[model samples]
Target: MRIGYFLSCEEYAPDQLIEQARLAQDAGFHGLWISDHFHPWNDAQGQSPFVWSIIGALSQAVRIPVTTAVTCPILRIHPAVIAQAAATSAVLHDGRFVLGVGTGEALNEHITGARWPFAEERLDMLEEAVDVMRQLWEGDFVTHHGRHYTVEQARIYTRPPAAPKVYVSAFGPRSVQVAARIGDGYISTQPDADLVKQFRQFGGGDKPAQGAFKGCYAATEDEGVRVAHRLWGTSGVPGELAQVLPSPRHFEQAAQLVTPEMTRESLPCGPDPAPYAEQLKTYADAGFDEVYVANIGPRYAEFIDMFRREFL
Candidate 1:
């Protein structure tokens, strides 16, 4: 099981992002995962840098592989653009860039003035988007006309020897089935063994699967909760509606239910790295090829060092 970390969506300046990636590599992390968000989930947690620019800097700053933990290719940006960007980044990194993608949420997708598609419609769109991206990445003159996308004699000149691997971010049966059928691999936040089995059964082969969890290396649980709530309190919301809401402010509104007391339930925070390693181990044991850790705060260098000593 490979260990990596999620650069926080909340804290850290642009340069700090690359510096942390460098630190993760120096500490022997196998890869780095970064989130793609147009807006911070809340004003209290305010920082969402353009992730592609950060990837460009990381191409020069670190030797480890980097993946967008999940980017939405179907919306905000066209699949053609995503295909081009991923191809270039993969080439720049000498084939160390993996493209982790998903259907995306309203917070980011609705910005295009397009109505947010229903869940089922979103799945269909993702399927078409993936098809379009793969076609364009092949370096052929693509002339595709699909239900959700259309391309006319489109060609991506700087295609890598092989396209960067496409990893699907899925959390449900339908999505898992789509990932297995089309994706090179699978990515999920929950390390559910059954879901992994479903993906493999559906056709995901022995290719890599990734899992991510949140943790904070702090002196006390209280500190960890403060940081965790500041970063990811919306996990406590009871239903999917809150998650699919149109704006990040809606998340902040729902996250009000996530008190510091609930933070213990949401994150694995402690003075030592044992809990972090233990949580990550669940993903490995579930057969994930890679396990990503999302530090709840800007303790990247320190957490990388401590986690390496304790787990890696």
Candidate 2:
């Protein structure tokens, strides 16, 4: 499986992210995945720079292909706009960019003051948005009047030689089906073999499947767990809470119920490489074509070095 580094926009500044991309490429990582968010999950995570600007910088900084771990095109922005931005990103990356999209979360999309729709409704909107984006990427003047969106005489003038592949992110069976039906590839955070099977069964065929996981490499497991808890404890917040939380403060409130132990349990935290290797193997064994790993706190250089010597 191809191993990539995941850039967390919520936790690092734009320059730091660009630097990480260079470091990752130097360390022999095959690709990069970046989180696209309007806001961080909690105040402790701190930063959420405009992802498009960072992608532009990444194109100049590294040769490796990059993908938005997942961008939500259904709510905050119209699909046509996302299509244009993605097309521009592909041009900047010399056609080495993949567009990963999802149904979205209220934490980011609700900021536009639109009511958060149910998962089924959001999935429907995602389907329509994908349709609109694909139509726009064809480089023709198009008029679309769909249930959730409308585009009139829109054409993307600055498109790349070829449109980037669209990977749909899904966590459940229904969404997996949606991804199989509409996406060029599939993306998820879990290493569930059943989900991959479902995706392949539903026409995904030989399309690429990607998975991601978070880890913290530190001098000791305790330090890693502490830092991860401070910054990413929100990760342990269960179920639909992540999709429904309205703001950072709301996420913080919900994350209060999450303990440091939970964070440690969920993420591979420590100096030992065995656990990290084991975690990554789950993805590979589950049939993922690629897997991206993210370091939770500082010590990124150490993490990359360890990855080279131990995991890579």
Which portions of model 1 show Cα errors greater than 4 Å? none
* Model 2, runs deviating above 4 Å: none
Candidates' TM-scores?
A: 0.96, 0.99
Global lDDT for candidate 2?
0.93
Q: What residue pairs clash in candidate 1, if any at all?
A: none
Give lDDT tens digits, candidate 1, residues 146-239. 9988888989999779889999998999999999998999999988999999999999989789988878877776787777777778767666
- Please provide, for model 2 over 1-312, each residue's C-alpha lDDT reduced to its tens digit, 9 standing for 90 to 100: 999999999999988898889999999999999999999999999999999999999999999999998999999988989999999999999999999999888999988898899999999999999999999989999999989999999999999999889999999999999999999999999999999999999999999999999999888999999999999989888989999988999989998999988887888888999889899989999999999999988888889888888767
lDDT of each: 0.83, 0.93
Model 2: pairs clashing at backbone N, Cα or C within 3 Å: none
